[model samples]
Target: MTEKTAGKSLGVVGLAVFLSAALGYPVLIVAGRGLNPADGAVFLAFWGVVFGIGSALSPIEQEVSRLSAHADLRGGRVGPTALRTVAVAVIAVGVLGAVLALPPVAERIYSADDISLGLIALASSVAFALQFGTRGVLIGFREVKPYGGLLVTEAGVRILLLCALLVLGVTGLLPISVSVALGSFAFLPFLVKARKHVDFVGDAEPWSVVARRTLLLMLSAGLTASVLTGYPAVAKFFAAKEDLDALGSLFFALSLARVPLLLLSPVQAMAVPTVVRLLQDEDGHRRLVSLLIRGTLAAFVLAGLGGLAGWLIGPWGVRLLFGDQHVVAGWAVAGLVWSSVLLGAVLLLAAVLVARKQPGRVLLTWAVVAAMSVLVLAFTPGDMVLRSVFGLVVAPTVGVFVALGLVVRAGSRDTSVTG
Candidate 1:
């Protein structure tokens, strides 16, 4: 893509993200209020299910699109049946995992708050999966407008629906669950509209090849999800039951801190297909990589500055946005915010790996982070100080180091074409 085109794409993505973030804060405050200490655990558990399933399915979508584009560019064809079948299987696994995991865990490990949040998670996972699947197709085609529109639509609808539900006294677990499910399916209309702009239909390919590729994608996606979401979940696991409230508060703070990173997700989203296409041309690939790194660095620096500001004024911000009840989470929020800055930088490395189709390297890097996260949590004392120290400070710093190492190693590898 031309620099001008890329700049336009970036601008669109940034606008979409900023809009989502602006809308998200109020919605999160409302949602967070609906969550009590008991409900928080269930919410986290539910989130775990959502993340697990969503993660597993993500790679399938990414790989399918990547492979499909590769095939198309090389004058080859991919069977639509093969693609749809793999997608169906992925959906099946995700649905099954959510159903099984949510019910049992909610009954056993979760508090009342967790129970409600868990239900919402279960419902939302389906939506998350579908949105992600469609997004992959859009990215593969380098359709930035639809991709940005879809995100804006999802976030906007979810917020509106959540507000409407709250007004209707449907703020309980069951209602929240229904709302989540509705939100997940709400993108169908948009996807349907966007579908006409791209082609995903064709004859079926052999099931064996489809199945194998899908499985690899699933594994890679799952590992990536685990690394991303597992940190908070693991922190909760290490925390005491009575201290669940504080932990939940910390998780909320962390989520808030991640807002900036979440807003910039569209950058990475747009980068994937662009980078993939550029890989075919040596100079283009280098330029694309350089642009992505520079953008990532700039984003990280901004997030860090935001984090510093949050540290200085986080309590006031928390009080103003989420109310005084949640103000105790301020310090944790500040710490987690800075941590997100580090993690955002790490995503650049991840984007590079994705562009290169080096899922194995991505998997290995996350595995190391996961191991270190577990080790840190295991050794830390069960207190707010320890949790904050480990979860906020140590874990993210270690992940940044690991991500940097991967980026360096990836940089060192020969970039010659191999097909």
Candidate 2:
């Protein structure tokens, strides 16, 4: 992909992500108003699982596209082997979701009474995993427009269905759960043309090589995602019922913080394909460095603006939208906004590292950050909200420095390599 096309693809995908959020945020707002504080917490806790599951499984889509994109750059066809491999990864994620919902394991993460929601969450998860793989193929093919369409299809379907359900006076967990599970099936239409492919066994890259990369990215994606969405689960497990409302606020703000990060994720994901293709140019590493500097500046500028907005308006907005009863800790919102800012930088760094075939650098960054997240959560003693704020704030502070060091190292290494 040329630099011009790369910028355009990033814009299109990022806009689609924003539009999806616009369509879906109303449902969340209505739920916050309609449900009582306690029920809203319960609802959010389950809703968190739905999204968290999707986040965990997204590596298959990313890695599939990454591998296929390299092949495309090399003037080779993306074989069915990549597709078939992604299918297994999707299935494995489904099984992992199921296993986590089992009695003993489930007890550790979520309340057992949520078992029915857990089961429904599993179905939603599988559907989303499948959806992600299909979308991944489009990305690998560099089918940017179609990729944006698939994103719209699911979120659009959910909004329409959810609106209908609200009009029918259906409220509570059932509507949200049902809408999400069904919305994920919108990925079906995009998959129709993806299936009719013959494997070029002669041109086939070894599955093990592809699988190794896939596995590495999968673990990296999963860990990075856990750092993003796993906190609600931690709060669900360890936080007292009295602390649930504050946890609810944390989750809600985290979801808001997620918007820019999720929007940024597609841009980051596109980098592996786009940047690798750019490496063929004589000034490739220069182009790569320029991309990194631009991306970092863009990410920070947006994050700073977002944090400023959140600091100014987030508390009032949270209550107004979700409900007066829903707790909104102003500082927590600020902290989360900045945390997500740091996360955006981490994501861009990871994408560049992956494009450089330095997934290990990205992997180590996430491992250390994930550990920081865990340690802060485990050792802290205070109000749940303060603990959450502290943990969320501190980990990402650690992340930004770690990410910067690795990014610089990778850039220096690439300079030597290309020279």
TM-score of each: 0.75, 0.82
Give per-residue lDDT, candidate 1, residue 337.
74
What lDDT tens digits, residue by residue, belong to model 2 across residues 228-275? 766677556666667766677667767776676766756665667887
Q: Across residues 106-155, which tens digit of lDDT does each residue of candidate 1 receive?
A: 44435433455554565566566666667666655566888778768866
lDDT for model 1 comes to: 0.60
Question: Candidate 2 at 290: error in angstroms?
Answer: 11
Clash number by candidate, in order: 7, 0
Candidate 2 local Cα displacement, residue 300, angstroms: 7.9
Best model number under TM-score: 2
